[model samples]
Target: MIEKCSGNTLKEEFEDVFDDVLIDIGPLSVYYPPGCINRQVSEQSRKKKILRNNYLIKRNQLVLVRGASGSGKSTLLSLIKGIIPDSIFAVIEGRFQFVEPSANVFCVFQNPYSQLVCPTVKEDLVFTMENRGFSQRKMAERLTQFSNFFNLFHLLENKTSKISGGECQKIVLASSLAADPTVLLLDEPTAFLDKDARDEFYAYLAKLKGKYTIIIVDHHQEQILSLADQVIDLDVGIDIDLGKKREHTLVSENWGMIRGAIQENYCICIDKLSFSYAKDAKTQSNFCLKDLNLNIESGKIVTILGQNGSGKSTLLKLISGVLRPTAGNIVIKQGCHPLAPKEYCRHICYLMQNPESHFLFDSIAEEIEFNYRKRGDRSGNISEIFGYYFNVDIDVDVDLSRSPLLLSEGEKRRLTFLMAVLEEKGIMLYDEPTFGQDDASCKKIVTLMKKLREHNRLQIIITHDEKMAYSISDIVYRLCQGRLIDEC
Candidate 1:
């Protein structure tokens, strides 16, 4: 049976489970520049924004922090966990507690790619334990246990970069578990997994529950609600409370007519496309995708699904005019197409899988407004447009002189998406738009997609979330071994 405990009681019990283990934080604040740019000028002018006040977390209790995309949820987690420098844009107003001696903490980021520092899976696991001075025997034993637990035994010797995103996620968790930390924090752990992989991953977590004080920052509530002991809602600033069951109504409406029906013109057409990246020096013949022919209709939602390295991203790049096809020609309707790839960016926006790469401005506000002004359209104010689309307030007076790189991962992604959407581009390409978001943020993204479709814009999203793909897509396509297979 599930037992509900108060925050104070939970904290006490947690400290008792792992003696001297506690996480204490006084008031903390984080700041970002005025625009979402990564340059030094923007970074220097970014101002601190208060994130948490008087926040304290004890051991054993599972804490789930929910908020919008840029709501500083991950920033708070980073501050509490000591991931970034205190002297940076973040300022701490109070002290924090973590047990000395036996206290160990591990954090798994939302993007598994960023967490991987080693070349091979087995080496990655061993590296962490080695750093902690674990005996060789103990490290091997722990590796075996973790590999068995996550069904990653086959991936032990595989190149970490060659593994699927889902498998990489499991590897990150395994590496973290091998550290034997008393406190484990997972940031959007299931963002990259397929349905089956997600189920299996969570099942493993269920078995390991109560053994570690787990704090998960995630957006997939349906999968996590029953498992979470306590949920912290961060809708407003610094107000934490218990979670309640929330029911969401699934609204069904034809999104095709949002832009007043699709025109007969072909927006993007690809014929016999192919691409490959060398796996190793010995195998110069390896290819990722082959013979991909697809057509993108005007003002419709199209989704592409595939396991990692199935060329979904490669296909997206080709469509967005980022990558040149080695064998095929991509033709756009003559009158409606941009003259070149650089110019094509004006008409087609591609939200890369890595959000940090797209940030070219300093502050979140400036990032949003820059795209608006760049489009040469004075149709709407940046604050009002993003506020209405995302259902979140954006204070115009807030500083727009900070660095975008200083924001949390989720914030960077949201800002990237907002910039793309506000650009009013005709064709928007989203590569895993829900990568590191929580449920609320995911819903807001869906809302934004619907709004764009209402304006008769074309959207193509590459994702593994079946629920999201089905919910927002008008058509779905699957890619396997670099081939496009239609799933009508």
Candidate 2:
């Protein structure tokens, strides 16, 4: 049962028996960059209203939060986790009461890297339990339970730096769950997971549904909706068609001719390539990739699908010259010889799984301008180009001056993708390009890939989203146990 009060009365009640209820709220509103009320009316454009007129969250409720990118879904999770107003700098209005002693809440942020503090997977899994003063025996028991369920035994001693993004996400989820929090907030928790791993997580979450109060924000609505007891939609009232599908009819005529001409020139060639981190890293010691051979031509989009830590991302790094091969060579652009790292990078744009690593500037506008300056291409204004591709007014849908760090995970992915492919690079390597994106944003990326193909750019994508891979890719390959297992 929910205990509700209005105005100041709610505040007085909160001081007393707050711990008796999971969450009780009166009328509430949230604004960013605090003191938004004090700013001039004209400066309304500068401030962001994060949430308004919130409702109560009862004990043992599974709440699904739905909204477009940059619609404050993550912000709401932060508020519930009691991290806002202190760590996140937001102004609050009205009153909301949580279970007394706020440490009972746990949050799995969209980016797994932010929460990882330990160097190795084993230590990271036990980090929260140590902080919470759990008994050593209990920590060991919980670790075994979670590690078995997540199939993370092989990665227990692995350095966090050497693992894949999906593996990191599993570690974070396991670490958080081992802490035994009363309230759990998940922000796209399964975004980086492969099919089997995602299903495992869903099964565990379903078993935990009524045991703890859960609030999740995710764009993968089909499965999540089945577990949701209630739905909260954050309406920003801006209708942006960022996900519109490309007109296949328009490109059907020219695609075959373009492919035939481009096939005459191979953009990237990998011959008997192999990679290993065994000596340097203390885990996954059987060599990450082995004897891999692949050839991709210009004007082609190839997708690599694999389970977590199956050397898919490692393949991308090898091709982009981020990691040197143990044996064999990678030849680029019909060249007889392999290119040096610097020369290889000049013709490549690699978008890593974590988009935050790509940002050097504070604001979106600054990042875009910096990319423009670096490329020495003033052929088009980025703002205009962005507006055209995304079908949204940049000033309204996205705040150009706001820190790129503040944008939602989906927004960050889009922004970095634009920065990567906007230039005239011959090869584009994307690792999990569509993770965290909504349908519209996903379509926009696919459409952009189609457009880039017309220009004869070679695109190799690593993804767990098989449906999306089939939709956009000219060829699909599956990696397993450090080898190319299948192709379609």
Q: What TM-score would every model get versus the actual structure?
A: 0.75, 0.81
The residue ranges of model 1 lying beyond 4 angstroms of the native Cα positions read: 1-61, 79-96, 99-101, 148-168, 238-265, 278-286, 334-343, 377-398
For this target, which candidate reaches the highest TM-score against the unseen true structure? Answer: 2
Across 234-274, the per-residue lDDT of candidate 2 in tens digits comes to 65522223322222111122222222223334468889977
TM-score of 2: 0.81
> Which residue pairs clash within candidate 2?
243-440
Alpha carbon lDDT of residue 140, candidate 2? Answer: 95
